[model samples]
Target chain A: MNALALGLRRARFETAVYFRQGDTVFFTFLFPVVMLTIFSVAFSSAGNFGTKPDGSGGITAAAFYLPGMIAAGILLSGVQNLAVDIAVERGDGTLKRLAGTPLPVLSYFVGKFLQVLATSALQIVLLLLVARIAFQVALPADASKWLTFVWVYLLGITTSAVLGIALSRVPRTGKSATAVIVPMVLVLQFISGVYLSFSQLPSWLQSFASVFPLKWLAQGMRSVFLPSTFETLEPGGSWDAAGTAAVLGVWLVVGVVAARLTFRWIRKDS
Target chain B: MSETEHVSVRDLRKTYGAFDAVDGISFDIGRGETFALLGPNGAGKSTTIEILEGYRDRTSGDVTVLGQDPGRAGRDWRGRIGMVLQSSGESGNVGVRELIAHFATFYPNPRDVDETIAAVGLTEKAGTRIRALSGGQRRRVDVALGVIGRPELLFLDEPTTGFDPEARHEFWSLIRLLKREGTTILLTTHYLDEAAQLGDRAGVVVGGRLVALGPVDEIGGQDSRIPVVRWVDAAGQREQRTTEPTALVAELHRSTGGEVRSLEVIRPSLEDVYLDLVAKHDSTATPTGVLA
Candidate 1:
């Protein structure tokens, strides 16, 4: 059989396994929903801190935080999930065994890439459903708004998946993978508007957050899920769709190249 | 380059800096023959096997597996080879059947997944998640995955390391069954008994060199070593290592008037020969610093 067919088969098998695992499902699917629910409910009745400017007459914190929460879901599934899994597999000899097989290395990764996409897709959908039901946030219904979501999510998953895979090579061993990744994810979450608005963070912090794809992802997602009047809450006081695309696009290319350059079939042991 | 030789290496050397891990070894594995590379821990047996498996490169040598230089061999070459690693199966949650069947897709022609599972004696646990299975059962899954591709050459690296005695026996038979079906196997094992039982020919490596290579039992010409005859003497003591024990026994028989008490003949076992060779080699060679 051809490698593409086998890769898809492998992808199906792997995705099924990922879905069956309680921890994987919890992290990739349920955790995002839970966090979104808590954030939506906690900020629902709370007074506005930034004199928020969404044109819905009153500040709907859920609507404001909806896009960032989805971005968080995307980050967990695409970046943290893939990075941790690859690191653990590296230490356990799975990658080495797979390398020794007749399977093409690219096919094996393509299989994993599919799993990341599946999990991230499920995460985004679930978070959206929670926001719509509990917070009364509207879905992006029009074709053009849906189109924005398409490019943003596609670029988001592609960049983060490759970035996750590239970063998997950094940890010395599987046991330390969490130690290496957790801090980065948390810092990005704080700065990239996952929990607060980009404009709410200090000015110096805002500049730092703009360098990463997470900030652009959250910003791009807000463009899809929020009203155009909400752009004043952003850093530049406008919805910079091209800026989002440019930063994420550059990261997408850099991540692919970085993954190719840094990936190792065998674990690096001192 | 002979028609019957499936794998061959000449003057193979692997060096990490000034330290030689595999030093100038040459050997041949005949088609469909089970060849065992036997050595104690860190004897460079794994290094040699990895070079043949195309997972490692030799610093300087000519090597070939299935008539292709393994260092430059491509995917088509890989389809013809199979390997079971020392440790694996730290995999995602999946049943035995699923993982084995999935691996079969890599090869152009693969054996029936069910048959492979049955051969490895995992028919009962086919649907059980691998992490829930016992360590030995997980190993059987590894073997099933390895051989499902119907590889022309199978590499088993310390395959039975942690298996219980019964499980080891079953695994041995599974390998025996594969060999009977004309699979050329090259395995590395520290267990001398495993090599003796499964290998038509065994090579003993020590300190990065092939010290002995021949039929399993006759390694180091143990069979040709003299046997010692022991019997009660006027001194009531014993001495061995007699070159002419049979005639010596006759001479002593005449002296003792055929009343040979506590009479026995002692011959060196393969283990004795192996230990002797290793001890001698260790004493002579400078210790290479640990690489692993």
Candidate 2:
């Protein structure tokens, strides 16, 4: 009956519903594992593709791609999945029906946030497992480093989910939702170092990527996983935890405020 | 507010830019009574219900549902009221039981989920996914969700809008069952038959105002309206409208030598009265203030 109790109950129901959705499960959990396995095996023998200062390849291809793949996993659960689902619900009038209930509108968002967190956690763990055993990439054995990875991963997922919620309000129909989400996600992945290292990308692309939070989140996540000696490969050859947190914090605030402003309980045309 | 009055509204006004959706309408619904807000499309019926449901804020007015102002009422007030919205599209993955049970947790005292499902005639589909159900069955699920908490006041907004005849009858029975359990119902529907059958008293809303309000039989003051007498005569058929139907019948009998063939006295039905009221209201209503 209390707000907290109601929120928790709704969150449990929402998570159950999400898990039952076959496509959501595939994209959130199975798709990342499948992609990780295929990519790691296919590029096993080749070294990492980013260029060294001496015009030679740097790390192994699997090592360079591990972070990118992890970033992709975060994208699948946090942005693509949440955006599409929210859009479909809005289009179908489910959100309006929920709004009519005694349940607070905030409870619905809490449920969605928790669902994304759980799915993203499962996804990150699966990605790391495949990276460790199949790709033979070494994970951080230090407790402090693992703690940093958890914190950065949580912050990234939270920021991306809020951003997804904000973006979903723009698309009024399900078809338009897909159209908007596909291009937006592809553009972010390209510019955010999910597909290639920032240094290897064109100069303009690297500078453009600086405007978004994804690039910083991926870079911060990699800093936690890679060795201290590999700091030079980072954006500024340093682990900028404070900067990453600041950018993510700003994005989180903006995303929530925008969502609150734009979110429609009932379709305007309807 | 009195103990007998379940809902009360005074000077209720809702404006959209330069237009008024519901302009200064006032009414009250008594406890355990079936009250109908009858109107055609765009008649501000939905707007009034939304304001009562706390889904929208009125531009200006005093409105109360179950003795509390919906705009300022918190969760406890909401729990005491049930609302069946115009449409619902629950997620495809959740089964009926799962969804119902989940909603039940929001209330301090909720009916048994299985019993609620049975009450809505959805027991057979309890384990089925919401997406797999047909429109009518899904509507039953919506009703089940609405009443699972056993609300003291229930708002049904065009509850049978998409139902087939048989489904509508079944839903009517379900509503009657709720009434039997002493739940107050506030219904809005375009179907005059639904209003006539379910409502003890109906209010005709026009041009953002309450044009008429009374029992179904007396709506439009039709009982006092001039009664029309019809009969088959040598000139094909004859008709006359008069307040004194007994005198007219006696005069007709005297003219026909006490054997008037196919003589029939006709009184206006609720639909006829409703149409006449709306027509009269429209002609007199300000062009800008039409409720719909």
Look at candidate 2 and tell me the lDDT of residue A254. Answer: 93
Best by lDDT: 1
lDDT of 1 by residue, B86-151 (tens): 778466488889888888888889999998888888899998889889888888888887898899
Tens digits of per-residue lDDT, candidate 2, A219-255, equal 8777876666667766677878887889888998998
Q: List the residue pairs that clash in candidate 1.
A: none
Instruction: For model 2, name the residue pairs that clash.
Output: A47-A61, A48-A60, A48-A61, B42-B292, B43-B292, B207-B290, B207-B291, B208-B291
Residue B127's lDDT within candidate 1 is 89
For each prediction in turn, the share of the native Cα contacts (below 8 Å between chains A and B) that it retains comes to: 0.68, 0.56
| CAPRI class of candidate 1 | medium
Candidate 2 chain A worst ten-residue window by lDDT: A261-270
Candidate 1 C-alpha error for residue A17, in Å? 1.8
